[model samples]
Target: MLKGSAILEKATGKDGTQSNHSAGKLLMIIECLADKSEPVRLMDISKELKMNSSTVLRFLTALVDNGYAKQEPETARYSLTYKICTLGSKVSSHIGIKDVARPYMTELSMLFGEVVCLAVEQDREVIYIDIVQSSTKMLRSMQRIGHIAPLHCTAIGKLLLLNYTDEQLDHVIADKGLTKFTESTITTKEQLVEELQSIRWNGYAYDDEKCEIGARCIAFPLYDVEGKVIAGVSVTGPTARMSIKQIQLKLQPALQIIGRLRKELGYTG
Candidate 1:
């Protein structure tokens, strides 16, 4: 077997030690499949992953057999399968950081009668990792774990953005370019920078009709071992039930849970 250290030097890392332990090549293939606006062929996957066609074929065969990929027989194109989605949902539900939050999330939604969600900052946007829907007849988009959202609009997005260092934030802003979704969404880079600072000091962030009209949300960060923000937990709902005072009053419980879950996440800080 190849020594781990030898491979570590070749893998890329953001912190300088090229120590990415993930299945980088396979992940690259997955990325290509996701990046395409539509399903891709084996040749496209092979080219994107920069691997030999035969090697790519073997990988796809295994992935398809394992239910990670689905292939159209006539077209020979591959796409993500529902099984992969099921596995993703299962993993998100059982992740260490989210495990303790599940019970709390359930209670929080019930308490506020709103939608509770956990979001993580991935790449340049926010990815909904977990969500607890309160009312059965709620009027909002059904957010799945893999669904992506704008980083400058949602309450959780602001809270998660507050966790990043100034330099990191700059990089993200440069990449994502402060694209505005709704009219109320933060459009200026300067204003967003200011909001991030406020979020850090307040220990919470607010989204008043930014993500979706008539939806108001409040969010706070979930920290990790070093007091580093790993993800954000938030509650959102219709403006009628999500009034400012109600959101403020409900903030403490979420903040309290945030405190407990932070410790549970091994945050010594």
Candidate 2:
């Protein structure tokens, strides 16, 4: 039985029996092990956390079972697994990409008086991670954050598609089957491949009412620290307000913003 302590007291319930103290104690154990230079023994964890040895063992067992911690069979010492490092890297990458791109998205929206969207490719589709509506009261778009759209129709989608190899693009089109949303939507693999080449040459892509009738979008790819296309940024609006000529004239500012964003993300090329 553990002696009286604030943690144990807080872990105990009104019924006077030991409650689920495992959660807090588990965290404490992890923190204790993290601060140490080497794998820690069970007794050391229990002593440092001021919890019962049995309770520490129970939590440690759960950690090991869940792949968050590992134990040396001969030494009976425990340490955190590489899974934590993997999770941390993923979280950092996601946050870093989004953080570097958000200001650029907002700047584009304000500069163009059109909706701006940030999206990343996942499983051959473009998933919207963020959206900033135009400042203009009557001209705002209704696209929601976290919405998903096909990668063959939208400007952002095509911008990302430019990164794909010929074989990879063929595979995606074969699997996803470039279903048309409008008359302008690329309905064949050949047409999409040709458009992708043009996008690479022009350094940007235009939706031009391809995804939805009367909607126009101009998008450019964003590179990561590794010079790989990690996401796309787009300025989107109704065609009546954002015609092809207007979008062409406004391309310089968008390019400058994307250049700044790429540099912030550590893209050298």
Candidate 3:
């Protein structure tokens, strides 16, 4: 059986120099496979990639051995396995999200004169990945990138819970224990469920001094290419400036920007 190590060894040149030719070819083959919906014949792959039949077979054999691809039993055509999607998901979870949202976060922070944050859920907790500080010198919420906040008491956190089932919500509450940060924090499972329903209807979430006294936030969901909520973007500030009245006033423009962002992310719904 062909091995990845052997492929790498073969990629070395006679002058004892390593080249990325084989790796590039492998990527081309993978892209070719991904472009097609059905399993592809070996000759088709070789023709499309302009590679030798034997060379393509070697790479395909290596890919099959490594579980990245599989061959159909009857037709002997090749197709990618779910392992490729798993790897892509892992990469997608970490990269591009921050880069894509940073400009929008900056725009919101500048417009609202408050902190704008981009966060995603990890292990049932909200993790702030990027934060754009307020443009103004006024007092704002002290939210830092990489800060972990409870899902039950944060705008972005609660917005991220839109897809959770009742059982999943119960599991989260049981494990995370809905620790009350303020009197406004939802401590009971029933209250949290009701709050989620309201968020679903409202199409956004509010943090009315729930996580910290005198702090307020409004959050909207950020979708992925497939229209799935991958993360959330929120604007947070002191209650004096981010009061309910002010939030209601700024909601339309904020949502407009968020809608543009969603479209940029390929979310149609």
RMSD values, in order shown? 13.8, 8.0, 7.4
Highest TM-score scorer: 3
Ranking of candidates on lDDT, top first: 3, 2, 1
Candidate 1 accuracy as TM-score: 0.64
* Whole-model alpha-carbon lDDT for candidate 2: 0.79
Candidate 2: list runs displaced more than 4 Å: 1-91, 138-142
lDDT for each candidate structure: 0.74, 0.79, 0.83
Residue clash pairs of candidate 3: none
Candidate 3 overall lDDT versus native:
0.83
Better of 1 and 2 by lDDT: 2
lDDT of 3 by residue, 46-144 (tens): 998889998888778778877889999999999999988977885686578787778888888877888888998887899988888876745545577
Candidate 1 per-residue C-alpha lDDT over 1-269 given as tens digits, one digit per residue, 9 for 90 to 100: 22333332323222233234235655677778777777898887887677877756655665676667788988999887776676575356448656788887887788788788888876668888788888653746645688898788888888777666779877888778777767888988788988888887787888888778788888878876566677888888888888999877877776777677777767766
